[model samples]
Target: MDSDEKDSIKNESIEEEVEEVEPARKKKKVSREDDHEYTVFIKNLSFDTTNEDLKECFKKFGKINYALIVRDNVSGHSRGTGFVQFEKKESVEICLNQAGKIVLQDFTLDLMPALPKGKVKQIEKEKEAKKVEPKDSRNLYLLREGMIMAGSTASEGVSATDMAKRLRLEQLKSSMLKNLTRFISRDRLTIHNLPDSYDDAKLRKMVVAKTGSKPIECRVMRENKPTPTHPKGKSKGFGFLSFSRHEDALAVLRKLNNNPEIFSANHRPIVSFSIEDMNVLKIKERREIRSKLNNPTYQEKLKIKKLKRKENRKNKSENKPAIKGTRKAPKQVEENEDAFSGFASKPGSVPKHRGTFKLKEQSKIHEKSMKTQNKLRRRQKHELEVQQEKQEKKFDRSVKKSKISDKDSLVAKINKYKDLLKGSNDESTKKQKSKKWYVD
Candidate 1:
């Protein structure tokens, strides 16, 4: 009676133990991420939109747990996006089902589930950490197969299959590692703060001078077309320099980086193994500059520049010599042959004066100067015409105001100017008609 009872009780106990263990084991494989409630991301916000407005808009679906408009970390202005937290999961689903069509501040919104503030950064960190966690399957397999047995040699009867596989893996890993380095890097030089006059030829010359070997490729960053401010495709302040040999690139970096005279004092030079780091640095730099655009110091500097430009323009106009329409041409001036030493003044040929080379040697320089002067004159003429137009409009506005107020003097002055302009136009037309050489 005792043996039978003992056996039956033991069997029941073992069955119950197995059932409990099975559920526990299965729990490890299960993930409950879908159940996680989250804040809803709302995109396409207007700059003037406030947190209060967003919260009010989100309140119709359900009780808002929290709501916030994402703002620039440095400037404290809206980044044109926001998040709304809901108390219930049903509300988030309803918002998603709306297809992000909530019109707030005249913009149809785009919506998605919002992640926690550092979730993205944390995930990136995890991915990086995972890479360094010894994930080599071959290594794991070798260790498990006792292929890494200590004090073993070829004569010790180690499996030929295991040895061959191990050697093959080692060779493959080495080759891959070498190729990986190549894929991630290129010999690059970062030229920053390029001069306004920097060109591809000059850049190549400089690179050759510093490195003693010519770069495989050289480029001076330039705009594709002229802008309102820059009438030429000017240097964009930075460029990439590449070399076939990395050593030469390193030489350039050591020679030119921060040596202001060669690369221009304004733009610094940097040598890099890869252009990626340079690009990343540029991005960060641009972000910092953008963040500081609203800064008082930067604004003051801009105002100072504007004032300086105005002053320079004023001084230039005031100091300019009057143009003489009948001035003698330089080529028509006759000179004696004995007037200069070590040079002869020949007819129909440019002659260089003693210790001074002038007029024709640097035609490009002269051309650039002429172009600049022409541009300045055109700009001044335009500005003057604008000023005149503004004055006329102001006078007309005053005349209208005077007529409304029954002031006769201002109306008379406006009429007098209008009559003068009309008379000038009539005279010019009459002159054109009288001239025999007038073009139709």
Candidate 2:
């Protein structure tokens, strides 16, 4: 072949290769441009919502390429948001237009146009740049560069001590915000106007899905008595939930309260802190009062009062002159003084007790009789002990006799068994001798 023909053919082949490569490059460019246009970003999604649910919700708009629920890498739980890509860009526009009105799985969707990572970053930077500063800018400080203080060791930049102080202040501010949030929330919540279909399990699940925390207790208040039609009792359209931590309760209240779309209920559910019962407060106060009244100090005070009252009665009796009709005989007055010393001490102070001398003489006689009765009881107890010992000795003697009899019986049985064994051995030996004689 000629050199000129070879060069011409090579030039034509190069032109064809360029033509093939240009179309593929153009196609890639077109695909890149359409990537963000057909995809829709969804916010405020329910955690239980799945990718299939997302596709089913927006299938009416256009053909879906795929739907995805963003999930945590470690836990594999939904992040409460997702993305949906459509075959046509017009479907995404339609979905975004009906964003707030669309409800899927009882959750209202907040839709936005999906953007590339670089574009999203650029938009955020622009927003930060466009933010208007306060009119009195002198109060604002920048962390990167600020006026050098007189005490700063570094002449050109912020000192190490100042940096440390700034970091400490930031930490304190963050901690204060966390504590403030905790204080703002409550452990128990009262929910009003709940749906008829809602029950304890559903309420707990909803709270867990919203807050990622389980409630300590959850219940739906029902009718006092169940009717034939409603065997489980009809719901009163209210419920309560108690959470372990204030943050969980706050998260549930923020996410579920006043959001009718969560339950698709006709009315907005009201969630607020549960009010403590007045009866409970009264019971607590009554218990505290009862405890105080039964205290040792109060008991001692009561005993002191009784002693003072007795001393006061004694003084009153001593000041009063003896009346003619109330005068007692000398012997009777002495007996009265002895009997009433612990109570009133003075004679005839209390006429409730009469015939004191006769009663004292009878009490002395009764004491002598009681002592004699006790001595008789002690004698009876000693006799019972002696009888028990005699019975025990008789029982021991009988037990020894029974043991001797059992031993004689066992010895006789052993001898009889030995004689029977010897007879059997002699019979076997005779049979063996007869068999040997027969063989010979």
Candidate 3:
């Protein structure tokens, strides 16, 4: 070969070697700085998924360089998030396109391109910047669009979107205020901490006494049961009083608010303008809806309930007989030889037919018996009272007799002792007189 041709061949070989090294260097630079472009961040991963499991899940999509589940350092448990790095950036695009459709170990994955370094911090800063501080009186006008502030540039002009938002905010404020005011009833007052003995009649009388005016309507909230002590219902310690005039309601509120004498000790009544509670309003609305006959479902339910009640009534009537009271045994009926062939005949016996009594006669008999039993019970109670009174009187007479006997015995003993002392004194006086005479 010629010398020039040998030189050209050497140069060509050197050029090919340089080209291969350049491509290799470029690949290393791309891997180091552009790794985020080829990696995908998967969220909502199953905690039980391991690196091998994740890799197996995505291996069908593309060649994966690595699959890892982000784990807590101390506990060695999955953080429910991980990263999947592919050999090419195209694989990341393909995986992201599948996004929510990818399921790994019974978990739907949310896939996104892995953020480059410092990108997350930038996003957080942008979010913080987007948050608006609460506007008060000073900056309130500034928040409203189309309001020209002094010494400010108007080059941007007023944005229609900002103006619309401001209008919406105003509407929202008005709606909120209306809702708040709607809860207050104009001519009604709520009374709390009422006496347990106060029912509708007593509560109305109290309102008339305190306020010196009759209320239009008064109701004490109560349990849904009728008790012996309270025939209507038991008081729930609260009530509502409504007046025809708003001024009268206000006057009643002032008279009853924090009134310590109205209720028992330590129970001061709390009276205020009746504010309808939302939960109570909801319950009232539900009851009203249920009560409306126009609703087909409610009508059907009522029909079913009526049918059940009818069935229950029929069962009760069939199972239980009337005239449940004490009565004499029924007289035995005589059997006829022709009608009852098996019966034996007795001489001089009349054949009497069995008779059926009417319901009215049975009912009258039961009522008469009940009345007699009640009279007997009352007579027995009266007799017991009379016996108790007689016993008490006898006890009193015995106690008086014992006292009189004791007093008489004490008086007789005193008189006998006094007589004995007088006799002894006379005997001593006689002896002294004899001595004196002898001396003389």
Candidate 4:
């Protein structure tokens, strides 16, 4: 061959060798990275779709290694979700991208990559954690939406939503102020025994006359307010008085709290703090209770519930029929004495043919016969006792044949018997073996 041809041949062989090595390396890389089974979780499938239906629909894209529509184990019905595994990774990508357009038995497919069982559970836990949200500005907006009437329409520029929120905040502020005012006048006094004829002006004059100092405010509730029918508001017999100083209020409370002829000339006054004071005390008590319950080391403080279960088996085992306190036997009964059933027989269970007179005669006859039977039984019992004595004597004589065997010699006797049996070769051994037949 020519030199140029030989050089061309050597280059061609080297190129072929390099091409083979490149393909081998590519195959190795594919095995390590892209060799996993490309599985897709498909949802919104028709209930009638079967594994065969899925395989036929997806087989056009690539060779499907497996296709299964999950079914209820008990009902054998499709679960509307399925798994499809394609042999090639590119097929899964193609299926995912075309998921929106693909239709399976009148339903569009929803497809995504199927994660491992552990990863699915972890994702669910994260979703649950995200669901628990703290209070924020959005809560007010939500409340506004709920509170607005359906018929009430909204307008632009400071809509009803904002108006509702502003109104709610104002109401909350007023309530907070009221509560604070109550706590601030914790030492203020109230009297419930004032006469219904007394008014706010009259009570104020009395306080000034007694304490020699004017109060900050005096409120008197009317039993009925002045209306078109009445020109004067009737006093309700209860009122609150606040002082500028706590010491002045305490001094006024001590003198006229239960004093007659001051607020009440006839009886003592029901004097105390406002209802808010009691509520504050209750709040403190509840806080202490919650703290005790929340303590982890105090096992008894935690709520423990005891459930009562019906003891079916124990009650059934204890079910026994009453045996004593039987009713009197009926007259004219044809029932045999041996046929005495448990407790008692029904009232009308006697045979129709038996007469009451026959029953009375039978009772007398039965008594006389019982007496004769008792005498005969006594004679027979005596004879049996004599016979038992004779049998016992015979048994004692037979037992005496073995004559005072020592307990310690039992092991020696057992060993000696075993040796005698073992020494036999055929005849005696065969006899012993023949005697070993079971009783049953």
Candidate 5:
């Protein structure tokens, strides 16, 4: 072949190689950049999720580049949706394969490719716009639009479309009403002094019979442990019952209050019922019941006084002073009439003196007992100090013994090394002298 032709052919071949290699290089760079851009949408997340939770959940698939949970702006609760990005394509595929296979808190996870960022932002904006309208206005608007979509007005007869729309609207209204009514109708009935063996089901049934509806829920009050009462650990003998309807709750309250059999003779039935909106009643009842239970009554005070008087009589009889009766002469009385008359007091007068004296003696005895208690306390304090000192001394002695033993072992090791070195040197000297004689 000619040289010019060969050179032309070589140039063409080089160009072809360059074209082929450049496209591949570009493709590899593109792929590497796209790897980090891949994101997965995770659903059924917990409402209380944090960024750390999202990272931990996606960490099993691959190195999580970033993670975030969508949150409500006002409520600050997670919206149960989030995104996780990975730096590897294989990780994305693996996550999708196990999408619904993973479960968290009884909810299955749903993983899919994240939608475009524009679409997500658009959806969030729409949601925010919807939320900005007042709730009542929003509901009325929905109702009106729904009716229009149904091809009928509230007064006009419903068309076939209207019937379908009405059904849908009714369902929505029912759900909304159910949620709204929960806060309005139910009342918390706190029945105190309930028998320990009282059956919750039976009580609910009884309440239902009286109110025409079963209680929505019921729970037994936990015993004292600082629960709304004194004598911590004592169950106030009561529990709470939440009714499904307010009328039913009020009816139950009326019947329970009027029934005499419900309360013991000494203790009246203390049935307090209040709507959830009126939480102040719970606080008030707690204070009132605590005060009534702790305070003493008028009858109790009188009984205590009688008991104290009886105790006094018993103590006086035990420590009665002996009195010897004596007769006074009339002539001596006449000689010092005024002085003698005062001395010749009636027996009753002497009894009063004896009572006063006995009271003073009792007071003195009580004071002596108090002093004896003080001395006993001092003695106990001295004994405790002595015991503590003895324990400290014993602890110190053990510490010193351990230190002394450690020192002795170190000294013994040093002395043994010195003796070995001296013995070895002496032996070496003797061997050297004997070797010199042999050589000569």
Candidate 6:
């Protein structure tokens, strides 16, 4: 083949290889447009189902960008619903059709497009409404008039209007009136061992009959077992009864605390109750009072006052000169004669001078005794040294005598052994000579 023909063949081969590689590149970039995608819900999942399982199950129809299985917050178990995102609307419809009613473990799946934003908001609103409605119903009794009272300092015969003014009802309404009235009127009644199927209305009727009230409000404090002290399950057989009147509440407490019949089939008591005043105290005033009561400085001041009184008593006792005996008139006669005459008299004339002279004499005697003790101790030390020297000389002489005697005894034994050995050798030689003559 000519060179031009050969180059043309080589070019064609390279072109074919380029076309093969280009198709793969195009396949990678060929993704379904974002507008074509929508989230699809997959329901009836097994409790243990996971996101990866949902993706893998849907991937057969088309590309699944993401998948998730909803789980319960408390149980950490699947909620039997999940979401799957497909890259194409067509794929989403296909997944819905194919996966719908699919049996997974013990559940049958339901596939549909996820609720739109508007529908989601509506559902959330419904849930919030349901939650708020119950609380409002429980608290409706607080709106009744004449159910609360202000402090007694208000005008003695004050009407409701006057009382309201004194208590600042306008501000109270905006802040604490509702809560405080509710707390004051509320009574805690424990219903024990109630059946699982017991309803609040039935429980309320039972409480009303016991307390003689038209309506009784009750709430089952949710049991939270993980918090063993507070179980999350329905109160096994007990719940609290809150009354709208303090009179009814006190009556319930008086009658029910340990009355066994008040409890359900479980025989637990239903009469326990606590009344709490929900009034809010001024924090600053409370804090000021507490500081005064607990102040370390205040306590220290009290301690110092006590110590000062004790010290004054001790000083008074020490400063009061001791009286030798009861007062005498001779002491006055001497004072009247002359204070200067006493000073000019001889040094030993007065009893005080005589006591001083005796004290001096005692001190001299003690000093002379100490000097005699020192001389005796020195003489004892000298005598001890002389005795020690004599003992050391006697030990040296005894050791030398013992050494000479041991050497003499050893020399005598060696000479005696040598003489015996010489005699034995001479006898042996004579015996050998006699044997030699016989052989010749």
Highest lDDT: which candidate? 3
What tens digits encode model 6's per-residue C-alpha lDDT throughout 1-440? 99999999999999999876454334334544342246787777887876666767777778866676777889878788887766678887776777545676667788777776567799999998776322332232322212112222211222333223313322333343334333323344454446565667777776678656654567655555545443445555556676665456545554443333554322333333332333333566688778977987987887899999999999988888777556664321121121111111111211111233433443444445545656787999888998888898889888889888988988988877886775544777668656755534
lDDT of 1 by residue, 57-120 (tens): 8888898756778889899999999877777889999988996578987899999887654686
lDDT values, one for every candidate? 0.59, 0.63, 0.65, 0.59, 0.57, 0.54
Query: Model 6 shows how many backbone clashes?
Result: 12
When summed lDDT is taken over every stretch of 10 residues in candidate 1, the lowest stretch is: 336-345
Per-residue lDDT tens digits of candidate 4, residues 112-205? 8878766779999999987854433111211121111212221112223233443343344235434432332444566666776677798899
Write candidate 2's Cα lDDT for 325-381 as tens digits: 665743321211211011111212121212335334434444455466668989999
lDDT minimum window of 10 residues, candidate 3? 139-148
Error of 6 at 198 (Å): 39
Query: What's the TM-score of every candidate structure?
Result: 0.25, 0.23, 0.26, 0.24, 0.22, 0.26
lDDT of 3 by residue, 353-375 (tens): 11223323433444455466668
| Cα misplacement distance, residue 434 of candidate 3 (Å) | 44
Candidate 4 error regions (>4 Å): 1-37, 73-76, 130-440
- lDDT-based ranking, best first? 3, 2, 4, 1, 5, 6
Query: Candidate 2: misplaced stretches above 4 Å?
Result: 1-31, 123-440
lDDT of 5 by residue, 1-440 (tens): 99999999999999999876454234334433344347788888888777776778678989866677788899878899987778777889888989779776677888888766567799999998777433341122112111111111221222233233324433444444343322222355666546655556766766666546677777666563654433344444667878655445544554553233444432333344422323555789999888866877955876899999999999988887688447674332122121101122211211211133433443444445546666898999999999999999999999999999999999999988997776744877668756755544
Q: For each predicted model, how many residue pairs clash, with residues at least 3 apart or on different chains?
A: 1, 0, 0, 0, 5, 12
